[model samples]
Target chain A: MQLTQFLSRRRAQKAESRSPLFSFLYSRKIAPYLFVSPFILSVLVLYLYPFYSAIQMSFQRVLPGQVFYVGLENYERVMNPIFFRALQNTSIYVVLTVILLTVLPLMLALILNHRLTRWSNFFRAAIFIPALTSVVVAGTIFRLIFGESDQALANQVLSFIGFSPLDWRYEAWTAMFLMVAMATWRWLGVNVIYFLAALQTVNNDLTEAASMDGANALQRFRHVTLPAIKPIIVFLVTITIINGFRMFEESYVLWESSSPGYIGLTVVRYIYREGIQNNALGFGAAVGIILLAIIFVVSMIQLYLTGAFKKEH
Target chain B: MVHGRQDKLISAGLLAILIGFAFLSLFPVLSLLVASLSPASDLMRYGLAPELFFSSFDLENYRVIFGPEGSRYWTWYLNSIIVSSMLIALSLFFSSMVGYALAMYEFPGKRFIFIMVLLVLMIPFEIMMLPLFQLVITLGLIDTYFGTILPLIVAPVAVFFFRQYSLGLPKEVMEAARVDGCTEYGIFFRIMVPLMLPSFAAMAIFQGLISWNNFLWPLLVLRSNDMLTLPIGLATLLTPYGTNYQLLFAGAMLSIVPIVILFLVFQRYFIAGLMSGSVKG
Candidate 1:
C-alpha cells in the first residue's frame, strides 16, 4: 500500500522538470534505439561487413595487398577431388555423430530420469566433466589413447579381448570412428542435459494416465514423453548437424598437422588449409560460402520438416 | 507383485548402464591425469596405456611448466583469462541490454533485429573467420586482444538467449519503476538486471567456456608467442619435430581447472539456463 502511494506521488511529479531535450531523450520512442544501438553497430561493422567481403572475395583471387576478379575461378577450383573427399568424409562424420549423439543421449536421459534411479546427479556431473575440457585437450588425449602402438589403451583393450590390435588412425572408417567417439564423449553429457530438461516438461499426470490404461513403460514413453520433448529433440538434431558441418578442431588436433591420406579431413579443415595455411584466401572463402549455403539449406529443411516454422498459439 | 518385480529389474539394468557410461565419460580424463603424473619416458615408451600399477609418478612435467621453460604457458594462460573475462563481461552487458529492449519495448525494427540475430546464429564462425581475418588485418588489430574479442563480444547466441530469457521476466516491476520516475536506462540496470541474474550466470559460463577453449579465431589473430591462448599454446606443443607429451598432458590438465570450478559453482544455473534457451526457442 505504501509502495503504491509512493509510486502514485512520483507519477504525479514525473514530467514536471524535464527540459525538451531530456523529455525527448527519455521518451519511449528513443529509449529502445539507445539500448539496441551497441548491438546493431557491432553487427553491422563486424558480422555483415565481413560477410559481404567474403562474398566478394569468393569471386576473386586474393593475395597480399592485391586482389583480382577471377570470376568464378575460385569456386571452380574448390570443386576438385580433394574438396569432394572432404565433403564425403564430413558428411559421413555428420551422419554418424548426429545419429549417435541424438539416440544415445536420449536413451541416457531416459535412464537418468527413471523414478528409482540412484546417484543420477552424480552420474550427470561426472559425464558432464568431459564437456568442460577443450577439444584440443580431448583430441590430444584420445590420440595418445588410440595411438598406433600395441601399448595404447584401445589396442590394450583389444588384445585383452583376444583380438589383434588395429591402427586406429590410418584407415578411413577407423579414423571416422575415432572422431565420432571423441565427439560423443565430449558432447553426450551436454545433450543429456537438454533431454533431461525436456523430460522434466513431460506431464507426469499424462504418463500416469497412460500407465493406468495398461500401457507399458515403452508405450507410455513413446506416446507421451516423446511427443512432449519432440521440439527439444529437433533443436538438438539441428544444432548437432550444424556442429557436424563445422568439425575442425577435432580432426586438426587429432592428426596434429594433417590426417594421413586426408582420411579425416573436414570441410573446415579444408578451409583452414587453403585459406590460412596455403594462402589461397579466395578459394577458402569460396568453400566457406558453399559450407554456409549447405548449412543454411539443411537447417531450413530440418526446421520446416519439424514444423519449427509453424505458428503456435 | 509381478509388475513391481519387473520394474525393479528394469531400474537395476538402467542403473548399471548409467554407471557404465559415467565411467566411460570420466575414464579419459583419469588417464590424462595419470599421463600427466607419470614420467615422460614411460609415456613415450608405452603410449598412455591403462596399466597404471608399474609406473612411477612424478611432478616433473608440472615443475617444468612452472619453471622458466613454462613461462610462455603462464603468459598464454593469462591471455586466455583476460580475453574470456572481457568477452563475457562486455557481451553479457550489451547483449542483455538488446535482449531487454526487444523483450520489453514495442519498438520499430524489433522483428528485423531478432531475425538478424537468428541469421547470424545459424552462420558458423568458420565461414566468417576468413573474411574476419582480413578485416582484422585491415583494421590493424592482428595479434591483439581487441581483435580476438571484438567479433564475438556480441554473440548472436547470447543475444537470442537473453532475449528469450527477458521475455519471461515480470513487466510489472518495470511499470512501477517507470511510474516512480525512473528513466528507461535506470529501470533496466536497477530493476531488470537483478531479475535476470540466472540468465547472466548461465551465459557467463557458456561464453566463458567458448572463449577459454577457443582455438581457431585466436590462432588466426594472435600471431605472437605471448599473445596465444591456452588451447593454441598447448596445440603448438605438438609440433612436427616432436610432441611435448609431458607439458601437453600437464598443461591440458591444468587448463581444465578454471572451467571445472566455474561449472561446480554455477552447475544449477548452467543447466537451467541452457534448457530455457532451447526449450523456449
Candidate 2:
C-alpha cells in the first residue's frame, strides 16, 4: 500500500514538473545530494584524508617539507618500555573505571528509582553538577585537595585517620587512585542518568507480579532489572573503555606532559608527547595506530563476551 | 501493614545513601568555590583547607583577572567563546542537514554515507590528530580560528543524532509542502527546521559544552599565548618552579560559570541530550 502511494506521488510530481526551473530546483533526486554535500565534503577532506595521511605518515619519517618511507621503524620504536607502561596504566585505568562507573551508577539509579524515595530530583541534579565542570577545573581542584603539602585536604583526612601523609604523584598506586577517583567523580552522574533512563523502561507490572509471587527485592532486581538493562550496561562499558583509552586531558591537567616517574601516563598522552611536543610526527602516528588497534580488539572482545551480537531468538 | 513498615525503612536507608553520594559529588565544587574566594596567601599557607574559609574571604583574585594585569586571561576567555560559538553554529548547521537528508530521503549511496558515519564514530580523534595537525600546517591555517574549528565541524555523533531524530518527524508535512510548490530547501528551512527546534536546543548545549571545555585540539592548533583557550591557559599557570594558586583556582572556577548557567537553564535538555546517545546506542 505504501509503495503504491509512493508511486502515485511520484506520478504527481512528474506531472507537476511542467516548470523547468521549479523541477530542476525541487527534484527529489538532487535535493538529498545538495543537503548532504556540505557534510560529505567536510568528512572527505577533514576525516578521511587525515585518516589516510595518518596511516601513511606512520610508515614514514616526516620532516619539514620532506618524507621518507622507513617501514616498521616507527612501529618497532613503539615497542619500548615507556609505551608498554602507558598501555598498562591505561588498561588499569579502563578496568577500574568501567567497573566502578557501571556498578555504582546502577546502584545509585536503583535507589533513586525507588518509589518511596523523596527529593530524588534534587539528588539527581546535585550529583550531575560535577559532570558540567570541565576536566581542567576538576583536575585543578583535585590537585589542590591531594597536594603534596601536609596541609592538603587528603593529608588532613589521613592525619585524622592516624595515617601519615604520602606524596600522591610519586607513587604509582596513589597516582592511579587519584586518576580513577577523579574520573569516577566526574562521570558517575552521567552514567547514573543512563541507568535511570534504562531502569524506567523496565515494566513495573513485571516487578509487581514478581513481588506478589514472593520474590524478594534482591532476587527481582538480580533477575529482572539486571537483564533488562544489560544492553545499556554493555554500551556504557564500551563507551567508558573508549574514553579511558582516549584519556589525555585528565592526566594532562593533573601532571601536564610529565607525570612523576611516568606513573600516570596514558596512551593518548604518549601520542601527544611523541607527535606534537617532540615533533616526531611519524612516531606519534604509529603509537596512535597501535592505540586504535587496542581499542578495536578490546571493544570487539567485550561485545562478544557480553553477547551483544547474539540474536535473541 | 508489615509491608508498609518495611518499605518505609528501605526508603529511609536509600535516601540517606543518596544524600551521602550527593554531598560527595558536590564537595569538590564547594571546596573550589570557597577556595576561589579566599585570599591567595591563606590558600598558600593552609593549602585549601576548610580552615581557610573561616580565616578570610577576598575578591582580590577576581579583581586581578578583571583588571589590566590579567588581560591575558580575558583574551583566552574571549578566544574560547569565539571558537565555541563558531564550532556550535557550523557543526549544527552542516551535521543536521546531512542527518535530515539521510532520514527523509531514499537516495542512492544513502547506506554508504551512513556506514561512513558509523566508521568515523568508531575511530577516536587521537588517531587522526597528528595528520590533522599536519594538514592544518600545510593549509597555513595554524593559529587561526578556522583551523581550530574545521576538523570538528561535521561531527559524526551529531549527524547520527539528527538522523535518528528526523526519522520520527511526520512525512506528511513534507508531502504537503511539496504539493504547495515549495522548494525542497524552502521546505527544510520553513517547515522542518521549526519542527526540529528541540533537537537544535539539545545539540546546542551539548556541542557548546564540548567546544568550551575542549583542550587538546585547541592546544595543538592555537600556538600563540594570546590565542589560548581557557583550559590551556589555566593549565599553563601550574609550573614546577612556582604556581599561581589564586589565578589558577579563580580562572578554573570562572571557566565553569557559563556551562553551569547553561545547565541550570536547560537542565532537562542537557540530561535528555546526554541520554539520547546511550538510549540509541
In terms of DockQ, which candidate is strongest? 1
lDDT of 1 by residue, A1-313 (tens): 5675576456435643556777677777899998889889988888888899899999989877888999989888888999999999999998998899999999999888988798899999998899899988898778778878898888999999999998888898899999999999999999999999889899999999999999988899889999899989898999999999999988988787888899989999999999999999999999999999998898899899988899874
lDDT score, candidate 1: 0.86
**Model 1 chain A: worst 10 consecutive residues (lDDT sum):** A8-17
Alpha carbon lDDT at B130, candidate 2: 95
Cα interface RMSD of each candidate: 2.8, 3.9
DockQ of each: 0.61, 0.55
TM-score of each prediction: 0.94, 0.95
Candidate 1, residue B146: CA error in Å?
Answer: 1.3
Candidate 2 docks with a DockQ of 0.55
Model 2 CA deviation exceeding 4 Å by range: A1-25, B41-46
Q: Which sections of candidate 1 miss by over 4 Å?
A: A1-23, A307-313, B41-46
- For model 1, state the Cα shift of residue A270 in Å: 0.8
* Local accuracy of candidate 2 as per-residue lDDT tens digits, A1-313: 4564465556547745668765665678989998999878988888889889999999999889889999999999899999999999999999999999999999999989988899999999888999988888888788778878888888989999999997887799999999999999999999999999999989899999999999999999987889999989998999999999999888888787598779989999999998999999999999999999999999999999999999985
